[model samples]
Target chain A: MAKKETPEVNAGSTADIAFLLLIFFLVSTTMSTDTGLSRMLPPIVPQTDDAPPVKERNVFTVLLNYKNQLLVEGEWCEVSDLREKAKEFIENPLDKPNLPEKSDVEVEFFGTYPVSKGVISLQNDRGSQYQAYLQVQNELQAAYNELRNDLAKRKFNKEFKECSDAEQDAIKKIYPQRISEAEPKNIKK
Target chain B: MAKFRKGNKGGQQKINTSSLPDIVFMLLFFFMVSTSMKEVTLLVKIKSPEATELTKLEKKSLVSYIYIGEPLSSKKYGKEPRIQLNDAFATVDDIESYIMAERESMKEADRPKMTVSIKADADTQMGTITDVKQALRKAQALKISYSARKANK
Candidate 1:
């Protein structure tokens, strides 16, 4: 008899094993990417009596009541109209006396350009729904994003995302997103 | 009849499936590479709200998630909304300590770039959310993200 050799393992079941692992990976894997609205919370400030108060015209106040009602700058407005309203408030295209004031700032890419001194203050009632608050926040953010896009398009002839880092910095400096989420107070009435 | 008989005699040859394992292995390798195992087991029922303007969170290691929603077991936990950190249910007070611990555990250089993501349910009241935010502020986790899904057009 010839020398004994090890029996060949069946290859038929190998495909089945790989299929099992593939299925496991397919089920266990979470392919969904994480996305969200990026916001920065103001650092905790010490209680002070002599803090410089912001001017009324310089602050664009957006209030959301518990009923999901929009109270924008002391006027009742709808959510859909917030973007354009906010854009107008930021740009102050006509430089209305009631709107935010602009000061000339020497930017890197662009020479001396006027920058708005506006701070968007968003405050909501404790009883308000999260969905409504987020909607308001989204509208405000959209307003700023639209302005940045338009400026980038005009200055560099490119979209905001396509602009160089320095160009973007200049644009950002010109239209800084300074949304402040204030502490919730008793606004139930 | 003769031609038919001849054709029947020379039936189609069976395909060689010897490389079937190779194909399966290739797919298996692909899935293994692309797979991102879920980081935490969610104890709360969270349905994040939708928003149009979104920034994709980058650098997985730098993100610390804070989940806010009603507990999955509403019977045992009552109907009140809860904050979840990692695997356990936590309170608003626990958030500051949780954030501090998370920051301490990270690399020294990465601590500043760390982002805290608040994944709050759409239906939850703003009261609880406010409390969480206040706690985060005290903890000095200023860079916060409100986790939201992309709004469908």
Candidate 2:
């Protein structure tokens, strides 16, 4: 009997098909990883005076005016000076009488340590630029980060991020991020 | 020259491109692994501020975005700053409902871990951001991030 044979399908166009799909993904998707400053907003509470007020000395007032200038602790200051001033207030290395007070606290995986009671109270005007606000926030954050890194290196012999979870918790307990962003008041521009 | 020319017998042979499909497939697999599918169509012009201390926003599926800036089409939306949620222009009051919708769409177990990322233009006024913050507080989306680019020192 005579035999009939079927020809193979052409695989030459497979490259074109793959190229089309690759181009589609390249055009539709972005190559950026979302990065940012993460924060937790204070929960809404009913109007009440029950909460205890922070001490006058413990509060580090940061004012961002309409002109996007900074006034730290009732003094005209530049953004460069803010980080050092914040670190000083938070660390109180010299135990300055005017700086924020520190209290002893028992931390996990670490012995008794004095934790600062400083709270950075940030207030911005209605017309202040968001970029300026973020800069100020970044500076303040850098201060805490530097302080944490110093403590980690001195005690744990490692950078802040490289420490173990418990060691990190101990460091965080010693130097917590205490920035408080107050609501903007209506200022006539 | 005559001696070298004698080595060539005829026209040059064609290149074997049987491996072309394999090379293309490699490229296709790379993009598929490295790039994520974009979920939102932004309507506002957002150029996020730059900062040194940055935290990478993980779990793209669990994060919803809020864009605040001047509208892309200023003639229609006016020059005033606007907020965009998903693919539409949204008002400050609409933020609550939008958060609720996003929360409802997610699985029950993953709702608590949801983080709202605010991508705002650097030049925008603080008033617009303050309004958004209040709305977020009311919506109970307490965990939020201000989207920014990594700035080198």
Number of residue pairs clashing in candidate 1, backbone atoms closer than 3 angstroms, sequence gap of 3 or more or interchain:
0
Which candidate achieves the best TM-score against the true structure? Answer: 1
TM-scores (chain A) of the candidates = 0.95, 0.94
**How high a TM-score does candidate 2 get?**
0.91
Residue A120's lDDT in candidate 2: 95
**Model 2, span B42-147: residue lDDT tens:** 7888888999999999988789899999999899989888999888888999999999999999999999999999999999999999999999999999999999
Q: Could you tally the backbone clashes for each prediction?
A: 0, 0
Estimate, for each residue in B11-126, the C-alpha lDDT of model 1 and write its tens digit: 88778887998999999999888778998899999999999999999988899999999999999998798999999999998998999999999999999999999999999999
Q: Is the docking of candidate 2 incorrect, acceptable, medium or high quality?
A: medium
- TM-score of every candidate: 0.93, 0.91
Off by over 4 Å in 1: A1-4, B1-16
Clashing pairs in 2: none
Q: Give model 1's DockQ, 2 decimals.
A: 0.72
Fnat of candidate 1, please?
Answer: 0.88
Q: How well is each residue in A37-103 modelled by candidate 2, as lDDT tens digits?
A: 9989988988877878778999999999989999899999999999999999999998888889999
